[model samples]
Every structure is written in structure tokens, then in C-alpha cells.
Target: DTAVSQTPKYLVTQMGNDKSIKCEQNLGHDTMYWYKQDSKKFLKIMFSYNNKELIINETVPNRFSPKSPDKAHLNLHINSLELGDSAVYFCASSLRHTGELFFGEGSRLTVL
Candidate 1:
């Protein structure tokens, strides 16, 4: 069984369109996070949700929202997608706020 799973593994959308990526983890972790990796391969955390509390990175735009429906689920919603938003979004989970993270395969979004 997959530890974590995300849908629409490959997304091809035009600029300005809105899209959502859903993620679920069965690792029984208390913290879930969303990390974005740009084409340059630089990975940065976008958001972290733990016990219903959300921490958003200052660099992340308002258009990107991370939702934690439950302890085992974390979803990302992006509005007005732009060319700069094209990248691999990864869903990850950790046993605790400072625990090792387990990441999903990642969802690649391409904006045309």
C-alpha cells in the first residue's frame, strides 16, 4: 500500500485557471505539509498543517492555499495559476512536527 497518495499526478492547464490537488496519508502522522519544487530543483516548503494549526511560508503567494481536512489528509488549492507556479508539488507527512518526513511521488503542474 502507498504511504501517501495524491491525484492528478500530471496537470496541464492554461494560465489563470484554478486547480486543486488532493493528498492522503495512511502513515498515522499528526503533521502534514506541502512542499514545492521549481524547475531549478530548488525545494521549499509552502505550508505546514499540524493539529489544525497552519503555518504559511512568507514567500508563498496568497493564491496558494493548503487545507488539512483531517489528520490523515492535506490538500492544496491554487487559484489564478501562473507560469511561475509551474512546478512539482509534493505532499508529505511526519510523525511529529520535528520528525522525519515521508513524501509522495509528487504532482507535476504545467502552465501553458
Candidate 2:
């Protein structure tokens, strides 16, 4: 079974449209993370949800947010999306304080 799974593998919408990507992990990890891979393929940490606490990266815009209703799931929601938001969003999970991360297939969002 896949350790992590994300829905809507591909997303395409207008610039101002809001969208979300759902992610679920069955590994029973304590932490779930959201990463954004830019066109250059550079991965940047966007948010981390651990034990119901959310840690947001300072560089992440307020328009991007992570909502975790439970430990096993973390969903990314972007409001009023912009052209710059077009990228591949990956969902990951890991044990508390661990270096190893299991990533999902990733959701590609294209804004026009």
C-alpha cells in the first residue's frame, strides 16, 4: 500500500480560483508536511502539522494554508490563487523528529 496518497493528481484553474489538495498517510506518522516544488524542481517546505500543532514556513504566503483534521491527514488549501502558485505540491509524512520522509505522488496545480 502507498504510505501516502494525495487526491486530484492534476489541478488546473483560473488565477483567482481557490483550490485544495487532500492528503492521507497510513504510516501512523506523528508529523505531516506540505512541500512546494517550483518549476526549477526545488522543493520548499510550506507547512508541518505535528500533534495538532501547525508550523508554517515564514516564506509561505497567507494564501496558502495547511489544515489537518487529524494526525493521519493534512490538506493544503490555497485561496485567491495567483499565477505564481502554479507548481507541484507534495504531501509528506514522517515520524517525530525523523530525517526520513515518505512523499506522495504529488499534485500539480496550474494557474492561468
Candidate 3:
């Protein structure tokens, strides 16, 4: 069984469209994170939620939002998507504030 899973593994949409990627973790971890891998394959942390609380918010745009309805779920919503948003978005979870992270396969978003 996958420890972390995300929906819509492949998404292709036009620019300015709004999209959401749902993520869930069965590891019972308290901390979840959203990372963006750009076209260059450089990974950057977008957001982090610990026990359903926002703990880390990186220098991401306001158009990107991370919603955690519970400790085991973290969803990412992007508004007015741009070409720059075309990349792989990964959902990850950790036991606590740190340590090994179990990551989903990644949701590849393509904004044309």
C-alpha cells in the first residue's frame, strides 16, 4: 500500500485555469509538505502543515494555497495558473516536524 497518494497524476490545462491536487497519507504522520519541482528539476518547499496547522509558508505566490482539512490530508489549490506552474507537485509526510518523508508519485501539472 502506498503511504502517500495524490489524485490526477497528470493534469493538462490552459493558463489562467484553476486546479487542485488532492493528497492523503496513511502513515498517520503529523506533518505534511508541498514541494514544487520546476522544469529544471529544482525542488522547492512551498508549504508545510503540522497537525493541521500551518507551520511553514515559503515565498510562494498567493495564487498557491495549501489546505489541510486534517492531519492525514493536504490539498493544493492553484488559481490563475501560469506557464510557470507547469511542473511536478509532490505531497510528502513526515513523522513529526522532521525525519524521513514519504512522498507521493507526484502530480504533474502542465499549464499551456
Candidate 4:
């Protein structure tokens, strides 16, 4: 069984388009998060949710949103996607806030 899974592994779109990525984890963890990796391969956490409640949000632009329907799933939505949003988005889960994270395969987005 996959510990973490994300759908729409690849996405290509023009600027101003909106898109969403879905994630699901079977690790039985209480914490899940979304991270964005820039063109330079720098990863930054965008949101963290614990037991369906958001706990951390890194000053991400309003265009980026993270939604957790339950402990095992977290979905990300990007509105008016911009060129700067072109990068790999990763979904991760941890047993706790400071525990080791289990990452999904990642969803790569490209904006033209």
C-alpha cells in the first residue's frame, strides 16, 4: 500500500489558470502538509494541518490554499496560477509536528 499518494502527477497550463492537486495518505498520521519547490529546487512549507485543522501557514499568497478533509488527506488549490507558481508541489504526512515526514511522489506544475 502506498503511504502517500498524489494525483495529477503532471500539470501544464498558462498563467492565470486555476488548478488543484489531491493527496491521500494511509500512514495513519495526524499531521499533513503541503510544500512548494521552486525552480531552483528550494522547498518551502505552505501549510500544515493537524487532524483536519490548520496549524501552520507560511505567509503564502492568497492564491494558494490548503484544505484537509480528514487526517489522511490534504488537497491544495491554486487560484489565478502565475508563472512563479510553476514548480513541484509535495504532500507529506508526519506522526507528529516534529516527526519524520513521509512524502508523496510530487505533482509538477508548469506555467507557460
Which structure among the candidates has the greatest TM-score?
3
Question: Model 1, 69: alpha-carbon shift in Å?
Answer: 1.1
Off by over 4 Å in 1: none
Model 1, 8-111: lDDT tens per residue? 79999999999999999998888888999999999899888886578555478899987887889999999999999999999998877466999999999999
TM-score, predicted candidate 1 vs. hidden true structure: 0.94
The lDDT per prediction is 0.89, 0.92, 0.95, 0.93
Query: What would the C-alpha RMSD of candidate 2 be, to one decimal place?
Result: 1.0
Off by over 4 Å in 3: none
Ten-residue region with minimum lDDT total, candidate 4: 90-99
Global fold similarity of model 3 (TM-score): 0.97
The positional error of residue 15 in candidate 4, measured at the CA in angstroms, is 1.0
Sorted by lDDT (best first), the order is: 3, 4, 2, 1
lDDT pick, better of 2 and 4:
4
Off by over 4 Å in 4: none
lDDT of 2 by residue, 1-112 (tens): 8589999999999998999999999998989999999999999999998976896565888998789999999999999999999999999999978899999999999999
Pairs that collide, model 1: none
